[model samples]
Target: MTSAAKPEADQTVSGQLRRALHPGGWSLRGRLLGQLVALVAVACVVMGVVTEVGLRTFLLDKLNGQLAGSIQRVDSPIGGDQGQLPLGPPTSGRLRFLGGGAGTAIVVIDNGTVTDAYTINQQNYGKPVKLPPDALAAMETVQVGKRPSTVDLGGSLGAHQVIAVASDRTPGRVLIVGLSVVDINSTLLSTGLIMLGVALIAVLLTALAGELIIRYTLTPLRRVAATASRVAELPLERGEVALSVRVADRDTNPRTEVGQVGSALNRMLGHIANALAVRHASEMRVRKFVADASHELRTPLAAIRGYAELTRRSGDKVPPDIARAMDRVESESIRMTALVEDLLLLARLDAGRPLRRQPVDLTQLAVDSVSDAHVAGPDHKWRITVPDIPVIVPGDEPRLRQVLANLLANARTHTPTGTTVEVAIAQLDTGEVRISVTDDGPGIPPSLLPEVFERFARGDSSRSRAAGSTGLGLSIVAAVVTAHRGNVTVTSRPGHTEFAVHIPSED
Candidate 1:
């Protein structure tokens, strides 16, 4: 079945190709253009034919009228019974060739007997009354009248003129005066050939001009693409590009699309320059942060190692004061471990590692975190407000729990023993679960609000009151919410401070 279907598909495609290649169904632009030109040429030829035929008909009508005048001039015969008519002075050989004339021939028919009158071409002189079939056909149908009639002979000699008039001087019922139009046809043919040749040349020239127009019109777009490709190839890590790195804007013609592209490219280059400068500043800040973090960790680790060595060497001889110092060292070492772990978690989050996500109830998470904060610092009044209805949000449950716990813990460490710490979870109208931890503590100064989410940024750096967890609690909150495609906002005032986490609902 598959093999049969494949052949059927191939046949269908081949049939389409055949249709596309048909005389009236060209598929390519070039082929279509050629077809259009051919149609125009054919139209020109048809128009020329119509024009030539009309002109010939008009001329023949006039010529027959002139021939009728010639017949009237032949009034009386010079001799009797011979049917020889008197030739006028400007008679037999008197007819002059009209302007660019070739020659002429004449034949006369009388009383059912034909007589040759004159012929410029000798082979046709004095021949039998062999009229063109068209002329003869016209004669058979025409009545004997003074007015001449014209009949197209349908060759080089387009039409022959014939007139029948009363001739009392001749022993004949009618006088058939006819003429051949060989010279007139030859002139018409030559003129038509010249016109067709000129028309073909003009069409060719027009097509060439059109091609150049299409090329020049599209040049600017090509330049813009090339410049963009070269710019894309540049290393963004390089701190700054010299002014020499600019692309060619001179070739851009502003009156056209190319010109607009040039203008846009210049603007793009400006944006790229600004972006690179910002990136460099960010890299410097990161380097400084790393240096500061290493220095801070080294001191604590060295202190712990030194104390451990002293304790091991002294054994029972070490004084109570030295033993207490060793205990302090162990406690500090544990704090350092916790700080390192927090830093590592923050680093992973910054690097965009996927966090564990599930449907977590923010209200319940807030309660649990507040309870933990109250136990951690029994002196602080930790208050939590959870909605009656469970407000469910998509997030990592532990991380959401940790986020509230860290904020409450910060409140405990910063404020005095009896400061009220409030955690609230409420659903906002914009399909988000809003969780805010507000503390009646000394608020963040206006100057530090912008950089509050930066790594290791802290409002109060006092040794005794500094918040634990590597000073990245707010930063982790920001990163986690950002990963969930949500937002974290902070508003702090002297007697009121709030950090809100707006996690989007799963629905």
Candidate 2:
């Protein structure tokens, strides 16, 4: 498709989706289900983050409050000479050994001389310390350990450190305490991961529960689809699937597609049943008309035969005019016979009589038919055109020849003496064989084109003479072409007329 057509096509699809899904601007069932899942997941993530942050804040507040209380209870002065200070009570069972572990220490600075004042362990506490430039700058401005400072303790320590401060109520100096935030961070991360694992399991269960709810809610719809499939597969001619087979009513709710489909199916079945009844009645009428017409013709035929025999027995004793009247009777009888024979042929074609089919050379047949028409209508010039090779097609040869013959004869009888009839046979690009019979004649009127193939229809209905024609020739051609699963079309104008036949090559 061109770019200009793309927008139109997209608009069509958008319109269809809107019609199928929206109906009245309300959320569809599928979208509603999806929204529920998304909302639940988002709520889970938000709650998880809030809870983790809240826990971390609470731990920090309790730890800082305990540090203040411990400092207030100290009896030593802040700027006293370097010495160990009195140990405090345990903050918790988890943190009780902090004052005497390898990872714990305390230090004090007074009069420009730094001293390892309170040692948790001599080997770990005696290590020399140095503060990072940024940490030292931040420490000088804030009071409470500068909100958890990190510095380096070099010489027996590493390039990374933590420096926390505590001051006694009577102190004239600052008491600094330090511990690695690495341990605290590792513990917080492990707790967060555990919480995340629990959250994931909770989310999984929630999603599965949501899916189950959706499946349960849609049970009615699934039942309706299965019922529709079953009903659609049913053969309507058998009159199965009574009205009781209908989908259960969902009240007057038109917002639901399932409801609309159910309602539509019920209405469609009602229409089908009515149409099938009318068709059955019409078929029966047609069968009876054909049977009655056939029976009626036999009576007149028998009467004509009886009268002719009587005339034959009477011989020359009959009046001359009476003899002429007998000849007229014979002529009328022959006409009646021809009419009956044509009717029988139509009936057989209508009833789908089997024909002998084979791979017939249509090119050869066209040449023969055209030559025969030339001989028959010596006044007209007939021409035949065929492919260089035989155009072989699978069809009944006798019926196919009859099609060409009828077209040729119609042109011969209707056109002026000098008119030309042309026959062409070739294969179309779609692997179908085409045969055309064209003539240079005063063509049929446009008004008669529509029903030209109807039984007993005549293009020239206002003939003055009673010609020996039943007017079923084109109708027969249509029937034969239809039985072969093909098509026949005619194009006609003043001084130009053509009838083309298309049949499948594979056929």
Candidate 3:
């Protein structure tokens, strides 16, 4: 994405993230479970560090004590032929320890030159190794009856702590003993590696267990969310809102946080449902009043119009103003009758009354409606297009005729007198009929196109009361089409406006 699109993509990703997480801003369950696993991992790491340190300390202490004891045990027998001593217990079965463990080294130097050196590691045999100059120099610092001093034996003998003691048999000689500590370090390093591997495995297993347990514990919360989502899809905006949806029984317990939310939502829905009931009842009463009032007014309105016409035609030398006033009265009564009829039709449709269903020749109906439009809007150019074959549909012929006439009359009345209005009827191969009324005129305002078919939706103010328009023509058209299981849509932009209706075709 470019810099401009990056923010849009980021917003999309963020929205997806929010939808994936719980209502608590992020993944509450995962966060809680992860913290629990982290606690276990920290404890494991601390234990590993402590155990490693303690084990190394204990091993080193034991090695140091064994080295000191080995120093005391190394002695040459009096008058022996060589540097030989009586054999000790040899507790180490595999190690030829004259007095110490496998990997033990014993070195004895008298005056400036080394007199003896022996080493053993994992076998019941001792081998001699030459001492380097560094070992000689370091050992030269130790004195008899002094504490054993630790020093590096520098070359391949590794490092050691050496002790110098006076020889018990030889009169003029001093005994030097050195012990190597390489085995102690090697053992500690190997054991620490094992502990580290075990710790990592333990942490992984703990995380897995924690995730499973947390998800299982949060099952009721998931059900609560599901119930809310299902309820959100309901169409409760108008009419009687039968909000019968509720949280599942398994998730309705008020002892938990999720349960509390579910209970609150249920209470809110109940209140909204009650309010919707009251509103729907009020609307029904208003519709009933309009229908009854409109029905009762018809007879009086007709009688008044008849009397006004009779008085105008009385030919008893009535004044010109009185005659014109009578004509106006008759004209207004006719307009009122039309308005009342439209309202009664709308009220019936709203009450879900069924429309007349029968086979009607749509092509013939279109021809007749267009002819009537041409006569009514003689100043405007009108055209109609239909196939030669008869097009039939199941509908009320009079109502369907009214739907088409309303569409054409709406275009003619709203547009300039010379604007061309074209009505085209086509039967699609998909078993539907499409009828469109298009005009070349100043189009509907962009803001009003969305609600043009709504009752009393007015525009231009000039057409508000002109030509006896009730502002309900288009609404009645939409209602009649919808009753026949059809749909109507309009698109209007400058200089072009089209209204299309589609209905199922008959065989």
Best by lDDT: 3
Candidate that scores best on TM-score: 3
By lDDT, the better pick of 2 and 3 is 3
Write down the TM-score for model 1. Answer: 0.44
Q: Identify the runs in model 3 with alpha carbons over 4 angstroms from their true place.
A: 1-43, 57-128, 131-215, 429-431
For each candidate in the order shown, give its overall lDDT on alpha carbons. Answer: 0.65, 0.65, 0.76
**What is the per-residue lDDT of model 2 for residues 1-507, given as tens digits with 9 covering 90 to 100?**
011234343357777797656636543455656677678778877877897788767765654554443333332443343443334332111111222334333444443333333333335453323344443443333354465444454333332233445443424445555443344556678888887887778777767887788777777678777777877777665222243456667721457766777777767767776677777667656745775686578688878967886786775587788887888787778777766755665666655677667998899899899989999899998888888988998888888888888889888977889999999898899999999999989987677777777788776666612665667778878878876778899988888899999988785
TM-score, prediction 3: 0.74
lDDT of 3 by residue, 1-507 (tens): 011234333357777786666446558677877688789878887988898789867866776676666655565343343443333323111112245444555545556555554544444555443445666667667777677666676656676666777766556556666677676677777877887788788878888888888899888888878877887898876656677888876576789887888788888878877888898999889889988988998899999989988997788888889888998999999899889889998988876688888998989998898899999989999888999998899988989998998898888888989999999999999889999999999998867777888898878656668767768998998999888888998888778899899999863
- Candidate 1, 73-119: lDDT as tens digits: 44334343343433333344222222111223343456665443433
Candidate 3 least-lDDT 10 residues: 88-97
Clashing pairs in 2: 78-171, 151-161
TM-score list, all predictions: 0.44, 0.48, 0.74
Better of 1 and 3 by TM-score: 3
lDDT of 3: 0.76
Candidate 3 residue-wise lDDT at 72: 54
